[model samples]
Target: MKDTFSSAAAARQAAQSEMQKVDRGAATLSQALGLGRPHLMPQAAVTVEGFKPEIDSEDWLVKSVEHTLGDGGFTTHIELERQGDGNARDQEDVEDLVNDPKK
Candidate 1:
């Protein structure tokens, strides 16, 4: 029983070491690919006109629209931006409000 426990502990340590190496390699790869840093958000000055929102709110704005055509069919991607000085918490609140029917 003691030998089995020792072997399990050894295996765990080896797995953890391998994972650390993998993480280091991934970071190096990201740096090489010019993806080491977080992507910048769109500037506040950017705006879209004639945007119609289902919810009557002024906090959210349309950021961009992407159209794609492929064998599957046509698809549209609409990215929305929340206007505020607050952080992620504020964004989450706005998302909740937009999704809430009782709003």
Candidate 2:
């Protein structure tokens, strides 16, 4: 009975140690990724045009950038612009500018 209890205690200790290591690794990764810790992560703080749909799209873009850049190397900035109506050429010009890689 004594041996059994000691063995169980040792196993528990080992498990706890491993868990601590995993937690540390997670924290390191989170820091490297430019993300705040779980409870205090930084938010984008942007004004979305279409709240529901736009938020989803923004989330997707962020995730994609995260995947592509590994961690803390990516950021997204959203700007709201108001262009007057009856401006087809202006709209097309803006669209082309957005599509172009070097604008």
Best by lDDT: 1
TM-score of 2: 0.23
Give every collision pair in model 1.
none
Q: Of the candidates shown, which would achieve the greatest TM-score relative to the real structure?
A: 1
Per-residue lDDT of model 1, residues 1-103, tens digit only: 1122234446444444444343332211001112221232333223333445532333443344445566646554545454433332344444443344233
- Model 1 local distance difference test score: 0.37
Record all residue pairs in model 2 with backbone atoms less than 3 Å apart, i.e. clashing. none
Q: Mind giving the per-residue lDDT tens digits that candidate 2 earns over 47-99?
A: 23344563333321111112223355444322222211223235444444334
* Whole-model alpha-carbon lDDT for candidate 2: 0.31
- Residue 49, model 1: Cα distance from true site in angstroms: 21
Q: Give all TM-scores, in the order shown.
A: 0.24, 0.23
